[model samples]
Target: MLIGELAEQAGTSTRMLRYYEAHGLVRPERTANGYRCYDEAELRVVREIRGLLAVGLGLDDIRPFVACLRAGNPSGDACPDSVAVLRRKLAEVDDYIDQLGAVRRQLQTQLAHAITVRPR
Candidate 1:
């Protein structure tokens, strides 16, 4: 399919698809007329890329994971490096969640205090 169709099927914009290509995430074939054509596999990769991005993984960090998937790694866990990457990402997510929780607590306290304060 063409870029627009692929984007629609992947729940993304053509601009994002182009950005993914630019980032070396997805590589679609070029038609003789110079139009980009995406296969089902590429579509799947695009979906995976979107999912990774949604989870806060930078494109650079996702490269190895994507490569492992493309290389037909049956277990996905077979790649020790990918496992390490996942662990690192998990740690970062945990830290971010902790920080966000602290921010939420601080906001709640400030809001409670504000409700008790008299307006001048």
Candidate 2:
């Protein structure tokens, strides 16, 4: 199919598909006339890329997942590199959660103090 067909099937914009191509995430073959030609396999690749991006993964972080898919694995996260990236992202999320918890505690303490010292 052509780029527009792929984008419609993938439920993404053609611009995003081009961005993915530019980032080396998806590669579509070119016709003799220089038009991009994508196979059915590229539809799956585009979906995988969109899914990863939805989860906050940047293009650089998503490279391993795309590579995994291209390697003929049933799933992108099946490879060790993709799993490593997942682990790192999970750790970052955990750290952010901890930081938010600390901020919540501090806010609670401040609120309590303000209530206790307010003029009657």
Candidate 3:
């Protein structure tokens, strides 16, 4: 199929598919007339990539999962590399939550102090 067909099947836009190709995430071949051609399997790959991105995973973090898929695994996260990447991401998320929690507490304390010190 061509890029448009693949995008339709994947429920995404051709522009997004082109972006994926540009980022080295998808490798579509050129047709005789220089049009991009893709296999049907790419539909699944594109969907997987979108899902990962929606969950805050960057393309660099998704590389291992893509590699596992390209290696013929049924699931992209079925490889050790993918597992390691996920673990690292999990830790990062935890740290971010902690940082946000501290910020939230500070904001709450400031609001309380403002209310108490306001003129009647």
Candidate 4:
């Protein structure tokens, strides 16, 4: 199928497919007339890429999973490298949550202090 068709089937935009190409996330074939051609498998790749991106994963972070899928794995994250990437992302998210918790505590303290020291 063409880029537009693939994007429609994948429920993504043509611009996103182009962006995936630019970032080496999806590899489509080029026709003799220089048009991009995508296979049905590419739809799966696009879905995987979209799923990861929806969870805040960047293009760079998705490369290994893409490679794993291209390598014929049933799941994108089935490979060791992809699993490691997931682990790293999990740790980063945990750290972010911890930081957010601290910020929430600080905000609560500030609110309490203002309540106790409000000007008449």
The C-alpha TM-scores of every prediction are 0.76, 0.95, 0.90, 0.92
Per-residue lDDT value at 81 in model 4: 88
* Candidate number with greatest lDDT: 2
Question: Cα RMSD for candidate 4?
Answer: 1.3
Deviating ranges (above 4 Å) for candidate 2: none
Supply the TM-score for candidate 2: 0.95
Minimal lDDT window, size 10, model 3: 39-48
Q: lDDT scores for all predictions?
A: 0.86, 0.94, 0.91, 0.93
Q: What TM-score does structure 1 among the candidates reach?
A: 0.76
Ranking by TM-score: 2, 4, 3, 1
Candidate 4 lDDT tens digits, 1-120: 999999999998999899999888888999999999999789999999999999998888898988999999999999998899899999999999999999999999999999999999
lDDT of 1 by residue, 19-103 (tens): 9999898999999999999998888788878887887888887787678778887533357777887899999989989999999
Our tally of clashes for model 2 stands at 0
Summarize candidate 2's per-residue lDDT along 49-69 as a digit string, tens digits. Answer: 999999999999999998999
CA lDDT for candidate 3: 0.91
| Pairs that clash in candidate 1 | none
Order the candidates by lDDT, highest first: 2, 4, 3, 1
Worst 10 residues of 4 by lDDT: 19-28
